[model samples]
Target: MTELGKRIVNILQKKSSWESDKERLLKEIQQMEDLDILQDVWTRYERVQKNPDISGTRNDPNSLLAYYLDITKEKPEEEFKNEKRRTYGRDGWPDIDMDFCDDRRHEIVNFLVGKYGRSRVASIGTVQTLKSKAELRRVIKALDPEKSINYTAKKPDQSGNFALQNEILGTLPKILKKRDGTLLKNLQEVYNEFNEFAAYMRKYPQVFETAKRMEGNISSSGIHPGGIILSPVDLSTLCPLHTTRGTNEDGQAGASKAMVTQFTMQDVESLGLIKIDVLGVSTLTTIDFATKLVKNNYGIDIDLSDLPLDDPLVLELYNSGKTDGIFQCEEAGMKQALQQIQINSFDDLMLAVAMYRPGPKDYIPQIAKRKQNPNLVQYAHPIVEKHTKSTYGIIVYQESAMHIFVELAGLTPTEGYTFIKGAAKKKPELFMSMKARFIKGASKISNKQVAESVWRQMEPFQGYAFCAGHSYAYAYLSWKTAYLKAHYPVEFICARLTEKSRRRKTDIVYKYEQDAIKNFGITIHPADLNRSKLTYIKIGEKDLLRPLLIKDVGDKAAEEIIRCQPFDPDDLLYSFGMKVGGAVNTKIVEVLASAKMFGNIPKPKVLSIFEAIKAGRQKSKGRQTGNLKKGIKGTVKRRKKTLDLDF
Candidate 1:
């Protein structure tokens, strides 16, 4: 054994109370050595087949090694072990999905690129395919070269008749999603099922033929939002590579600079490459900003990781349906679900997150009813009850489904995962094979009728069951945001507004402003020359001074305005014009003036001030200007007519 392996074994020996645990740790350590990870096991790892690798599958929340390695927050002995079994040395690599603060997620990506050479890591690519609607539109535009049919115009086409193209495109039926969560019923299915669509297709035979041929064709290629493939060797040897400004990890409307693989994520995985998702969650950024605001506003440094999961104030906020700034609970339906479930604890929050999806959503009221009266809860078998008791006898999570498969059907953890994946991905052959295995094994433990009964019970919602670990993470984030908003309302809302402002989502920022003033008794101050910073900053307990709220005033202009503070108190207007003249133009000054940034100066007056500044500077430089007052008035009048002062 390596020195590091021996040290880890020794540490486990001291902490483990049972000899069996010591034996298990020693075996795992040996496995790590065989996998060539003993020397450097601090990094998160998942062993691949006998091949040397360092990527891993879902972590066992109750595993001693997982906890000891600091890979998971839940302790080894935590009561809720909803995570699936960690299958080391599995046949294939499992993609690792991780979330980070959106504002700083690039730091992690950069770190990965540096640690692993840039040649070894690259973002995965995705082929943008044409859907049914897009295909129909493309076919319509191509067939109508003479412009007889207008697709976008509300009026008739050039022939002065109703546009048949609009009717044909509009007749395309919506996709019918199957129970397995796959869109099995797409364009072809629409034609088979809907007579109106079929008739339309039959009428336009050429268009239908072309649309069908073009459907699902590659329209373009783009980098995957968050999938990065890591290889032991240079990635170019395995697949094609290209440089791209990859899509943002935060799911926002932006991209980042990175090296991207020409192959898609699935294609890379099929080539035995490991893919990891490093998603940028904007909520994490909001939480970080809120915590810093708390430190600055209240002198209290909030350690978010160390927060108690069961804060009553947080629960009260959920129960009251006041989840305006809380993550994941902002949707109206989710707020109603919180009230219906009467979520009063952390576990309940997690359950709400898991059961809020489509397949399981129908059971929310039933789960709530069962929660009120535990006697009403019923299970298919003792095994099902054992795994699903926390969720009130409903298989609300994929982990619970896996647990049932392990105990009732005697399947290995890996086999159970495969079964769940087959069902979720709508692989009929794989799902049937696993179902047969499950029944054969379950029949040995129990009767055939009971085995079939259990399968029937799980079949309806098993495809939509969420990952327990994912739901828990989301619920924890929700709780943290709620806690901050509940205890530090002003700071949290200010942080939210600041983030929205940075994104240039002015409408949503104004909506939040109304919510704050109306609901939280907080006062929002407009951009003040003396009090405002580059972003929103808190004044007193209840007041928040906004950054520059003028249109066309971006970060650079705002920075210049903030830098030139106390703008010539003696000659305020002309001095203001002189200081911010270079960064902002006359239109920007008009907008800022209308926002009252320059105190009661109207937009026309602000324009006149800028004109005066220009004229005086020209005169001092020995430039003769005839009719200077007339020139300033004409400039101000013309600017006033064109100024967009609708902040």
Candidate 2:
């Protein structure tokens, strides 16, 4: 065994609380070694271990060694009676996806570059190809830049060209979508299936034929968002390297100082390089911030990763359809599904995540009806019942299909995985051949009629089936967030506000601030000089001081105000002018006054004092400015009728 294999054995021997079967752990370690993935698993484990505070990492769900090593956080307990299923890449590379706080994900990436020499670590590149709609427009421009083609005229005339152009443009086919509303990448499939589109293409071969040739040509190259490749040798020696422009926070490409591979993710992986997906999930940041708030306000330290899966109040929040900040449960469709299904257990929540997708979506009503009345639940065969009993005897997961393929069809795990992938990729020949093999193999176990029936049950959902690993991981995060929101509403909202504020989404911040006030019943005080800091802070039992959300009042102004705490409303402008000049500008003061940061002092009076000071400065350009101070004092003293008007 290699050092990586020995380390895996050591971890399984010592850290086996999650999977305590010593013999089973050893077998899994040996299987990983035999599969030539042990070194890759160890490499990923080392990279992730450097960032101890990462949310979690998810490896191949079948890699029990990964779960034992804590590289994959979710346990692989059987959801239903389905046996375990493992899907490998064509080249047998294992996927190790790491999730981190969205705010701090750059730190880990930088650390990886430092550890592995900079030349060895680069972001995966992607080639942006022209799609059907873009190709149609491009072809139209290239053929007739000056005028449109007139199909109806004898001389190919230009008089009624615009109308004819509109007619031809209207025939451009809309992109095809999966049953789940996800846009499919294949325009050829769209052309083949839609009769009107195919007829129009044949009718207008000049434009359509040119478009077909130029449809998939590369337009631009850019870096992948999350995929980072770690090559053993210098990357430049193996493939070309390019410096890509940075993407802004708003997702626009701009000037950047980062290196990327010239090849795409598939090409890089094919070159025998390891790619680690360091996905930045903002919800993880939300959970982290909320937990820290809980610790600060209530002195209750929350270990979010170790949270119990079964919480009645969290489940009740999901049931109530008030999951505003909870992950995966906030969407209106998901909330409606929650209401209909009434998730009674963690298992149900996981199933809901899995089932609430495109192809499996059709089974939700059946599952709900079955859940409401258990007698309606029936399976085509015992194998089906055994695999799908947890999901109300319906195939709701891709793993369930794999179980049927292996157990019923008697295909090996590798063959079953290939069949599932073939179906997913829409490889008609591969899928049809596998389907034939499945029916033949299954007939020996059960009758031919029964085998076909069970296969039919699996066929419809195979393409759209959600991965159980993904559902479990997401459901775990969703429940953790729901638990925090149900118990600690103030902390969660404060965290959400701070995060949104950091992102410069003031509209969303204010929206959630109002939500916190109306729904959480928490009073949000406007940004105050005496109380407010850089972020939302819990002041009283039910009160939270809103951060400096006023426009033009940036970090410098907020920080200066914090430094000079407890400002008198009467002398705020004077104090800022004397102590924090330029930092607290006249516009910032005006906005603050408008935001009611000055307590009972009226907005007009504050602006007039600054106006009076400006007038006094003009009058005494070179002489004594003593009269300006007195004039500001006079303006500050006018606080009488402003109180009694009750405006």
Residue by residue across 1-647, what tens digits does model 2's lDDT show?
77777766766666636355565567666766776767766766776586556535443444555666666665556342112333444553555577778777777677777778878988888899998777766666567644566657777765444554555557653546655565666567657656676776677678777887887899887777788888888999999988756654322112265678889988988888888887788888888889988887779988665777778888888898887777887678888899889988998999888877766667778889999999998887788888788888887676777788888978888787777666666565666678788889999999899888887877776467566777777888888888888899988888877878867787777777777888779998777776777788888888888777566778888888788776665666555444454576678778888887665667776666555555545555566665656544444456332321111
Please, what are the lDDT tens digits per residue for candidate 1 over residues 1-647? 88878777666667645475666666667765665645434454321112221222133343456555545444433433423434543456644676667676676576677778879988888889988777777777678634576668887455522265567656643655444446643578767755787898887788788888888889999877778778899888999987765466522213564678888877898998777787777777788788888887679988665678778888889998778878888878888999999987888998998878776778899989999999999887899998788889888777778878878988788788777776666566766677788899899998789899888877764457577766767787788899999999998999898888888888878888988998889999888765577678888879998987456787777788888886766566755655664777676777787788777767675676676656555544543445544554455456554532211
Q: On a 0 to 1 TM-score scale, where does candidate 1 land against the true structure?
A: 0.85
Best of the candidates, TM-score: 1
Q: What is the lDDT of candidate 2?
A: 0.72
lDDT of all predictions: 0.72, 0.72
